[model samples]
Target: MLYTAYRKYITFFLILFIRLAAFSQGNAGGNTVQTVEIEPGKSINFKATSTPGSAYQWFKDGNPISGATSPTLNVSEPGEYKVLAQNNLNCTSEISDGFIVTVKTSVLVKQANLSVEKKSETKATSINDPYEYLITVKNSGPDPATEVIIKDILPEGLIFKNMTMALQGKFDYNAAARTLTWTIDKLNSADMSELRFVTEAVNPGSVVNTATVSATEADPDLSDNSSTDTKSITDLTIPNVFTPNGDGVNDRFEIKNLEFYKENEISIINRWGNSVYEKKDYQNLWDGTGLDEGTYFFVLKVKNATGTWQAYKGYITLLRSKTAQ
Candidate 1:
């Protein structure tokens, strides 16, 4: 009986010892993560060591990503990303240290320049005219650029009339079909990003139009810093016709575009070499009353449209009604 009791006790002790070992291990079994990384398209995965029954959780920008309770995360966009893994035995593993994974976009315009022409500004050459100003914008990057947004600020007497490419402007703006558009797919490095627009100088004077052309990429991280340029609107044109009918509107008989003429001299003389009207301004006119109710000889001394100063002779007829007395 004593021998039998001793054997039973020994068996019980061994069983207890085995159970204890397993219990301790189950509670403190090292459940720790090894590595974490982001794959293409913002996907994430992690490897770890320890208890079974995998529990996966992903985080982005300090917010728990839903449905990411696995060892891998398949994301679509870009943001701060991380992951956590645990085992089924209620033993949690240490989180993997956060690593940043960013998807970048291609570059748009690389070189910048300005041009002067008739009616427009452009980045490339299509139709060069002395009657228009063309400001050239060239993109020397390898990446295919997205739709580009161009905002051109105009100067006094200079108004943007038309654009060769698709574009929009303030006041007369179209938000849907706005600015120059380049696909965001893939812009090769040696590609050109350009926009050419036309302008007309109203009422003649000195005009300087400043502008900034920016090439935009679709990606947020690599798309904010855009390209820029500055240009001037210089087209020296002279007015072709003027009327002096004494109607109080354009009543002055003088050169139209005399502002940019540098130096202008006008001489109106009678038949006896008597100067009746003479001035260097655009607002000077002779009513033809100094010679009486008859024909009077006149001469004009001024510069021609080609910047040549010379003399031109003409005649003026004055009629006096008897009812004037």
Candidate 2:
């Protein structure tokens, strides 16, 4: 009876030991899966929880990855990754959750260039004369550029006339700030667009137009994004000396290109500041008939369509010829 009881006790202890060993191997903690992103030509490392005397087998998309039996796996592609853990006793744990690795593409703005040119009706521009501006934009990108926009800041001493574009886009102009805007659709790689507008020089000076181009991407180089062009308005020349003797050759003190300035005021002042001749609209028909041969100061002020005025002052000489009847 004693021998039988001892054998039963040994058998019970052996069963308990076997059950505990199985439980310990199966109860191994699992690793928390995570998602990772890597750049092109790069790889990401995934490591599972290390357990002594345990072996690992990495799988991808439910298929075992050959020779990936270590506790760590290096992958580059974008797909689901998982690993199985097993102990010496052949007790295996459930495969860990999938850790996704995504490969990211690099997209950036390769190039952005803005160019402008001016075309005028005459070689020398005068006040109130229209000048045509040609604006061109190009994108030499390796990727598509979306929502491309171009902005132009129209300078003072000029008025906006009209705008046109060769490409499909939306145009907007602000008279108060004298700004023009164009918004375009997606611009593919090596694509180009053209825009044109007309403006009139209202005053005599240098007028500068500045423009810029941009898109919804990383503009690595911004040096070519903006461009500037300038146009100069010729100075109004008045005959310093005119012999208004009715000869029809020098019979009038004519101001060249005065007809272009419709909204203008002219005044002739004597040496003592006494106004001699004054007119709201001077038609370049000033003939020295009533005034004597003397020196005079002339003041000319012109207003633009936006109701802005510019003034010019200079000296004039009126003389009578001896051949006058």
Candidate 3:
């Protein structure tokens, strides 16, 4: 009977020892999982081992997790993640080291350059708005970029009054689309140095129209600014109409909105094709008051925009009427 009791005791002890060992190890205790990637809509798995009867708890911050009984969890923002294991026998394990979960902006801007050409800069066009600017960009990376977008941010809701892009020659513009695109091979190291573009700010605001470019890609965050600057362009246009009325409503019989025209002239002729009045670079009108009434044929003679002298002959009928007695 004594020998039998001793054997029974040894057997019981062995069983207890095995149970303890298993509990101490926990099912996935020692195995380590590295390189957990936490993307926007993705989850990461941490394979840990512990006893089959052990309880699992996962934590986002320092607080205890409720239903996080699993070893994996999907995270979206930047924060700490950890897991803890507890055995049924009241044994506990240390919290796993915290892993960082981070989310990044998908799009990136890249290879942006700003070039300025000064007018009056010798052979650089000569004027107050002496500088001309151009913008260029590329997707010089391993990933294919999609949703490629470019924005010219100007202050006060000002749009690009004058803007252009440069191809080897020039690409046709679809003004309705507001989109400029071309099928380009992978931009690897093939910097789009040959690419050039132009745009001007609208008003005299504190800032110029700055450009920011981006696209959707595998690693969009890698896209970023190449360079930035502020430059000016010729902001000019011809007026709509030239008033020859004396009341100043349209009093000037000069070239309407001709400020941009470097060379100009105006001439008033008589009824018999005889030159009565002439003025070069004239910016005003002829009231036809101090003169006699009847059919006076006026000729607009100028070395027109095409560098050719053209005569626009028309009759200015002065009907002896109105305030000028």
Candidate 4:
């Protein structure tokens, strides 16, 4: 009876030991399974609790990951992960809880094509005239563009005044630098935006204004990325009739808006095509002196900012009182 009782006790202890060993291997070290979601081109970190002088091994879907012996794992793929720690004595701890990392599919393309167009209704403008330039930016893309930047540096002879109400994004103009900058947070595919730049003509010449566009995405076509608009500036008005009778009103052969040009020449001729008077740098002081004028022809030539002379030929009727000395 004593031998049988001892054998029964040994059998009970063996069963208990087997259960304990299984429990230790499957127990989670104060960790719970967590689901992590990440987008494409992104990564997530899986960190395990650390113990002094301990080595770690990480597993993905029950398979041991090569070289994954650190306390932390940077995961970029979709998988179920778990980690186990082994102390200096080579005593392995329980497997930690699983981490399920899932990746989200990308919905947009990586590259986008952008273009810009600049235009003005006033192709020909005069000095002190207010005009507007419309700058349009388009996204012909397979994806949305972010952080769109548009830059337009105004050429000389154009003065920035202000911009009209913008449809998308914001704009700023630096008068000192003559630069206009527009910024948009996002521009979707097949989308377009516009900016109206109001300005004034301050000088004379052919003005070429260009606008360029860029974005965070890569543009396939750079040829259409920039657009240019050209405008001509001229300010002069000739009078058909003038009274040189010294009446303090229309007393001299004065031309409207002629003082703006410093370099000019004027020549007057009679009905017989004989030169009656000629002067360089004419100051509107000619009173048709030494000639009784009824009607005459005049040729006026003025030099522009480009040093090109522009000529104006027309008939001028000079009226002098019959009793004038």
Best lDDT among the predictions, by candidate number: 4
Residue-level lDDT of model 1, residues 25-88, one tens digit each, is 1222123222233344454333322233357677777788878676545555666565555545
lDDT of all predictions:
0.42, 0.70, 0.44, 0.77
Between candidates 1 and 2, the one scoring higher on TM-score is 2
Query: For candidate 3, which ten residues in a row score worst on lDDT?
Result: 117-126
Model 3, 60-164: lDDT tens digits are 767766787864454555666666655565445556645555665455444322222211111111123223345455545654444444444334422323334
lDDT of 2 by residue, 1-325 (tens): 7545443443333223222332222222234445567898898676665342268788888899999998667788888787666657554545665666788978743453332233333234557766678777777756667788888888777899997545667889989988898888877777777778888887877787778888877676687788877675745655667888766787787888677779898999999999998899888888866888888888888775568776666678888865736
TM-score of 3: 0.29
Residue 106 lDDT in candidate 3: 58
Candidate 1 at residue 109, lDDT?
41
TM-score for candidate 4, please give it.
0.43
The best-first sequence of candidates by lDDT reads 4, 2, 3, 1
lDDT of 2: 0.70
Clashing pairs counted in every model: 29, 0, 21, 0
- The ten-residue window of minimal lDDT in model 1 covers 121-130
Lowest summed-lDDT stretch of 10 residues in model 2? 18-27
- Prediction RMSDs, each to the true structure: 17.9, 13.7, 17.7, 13.5
* Winner by TM-score between candidate 3 and candidate 2: 2
Superposed Cα deviation of residue 301, candidate 1 (Å): 18
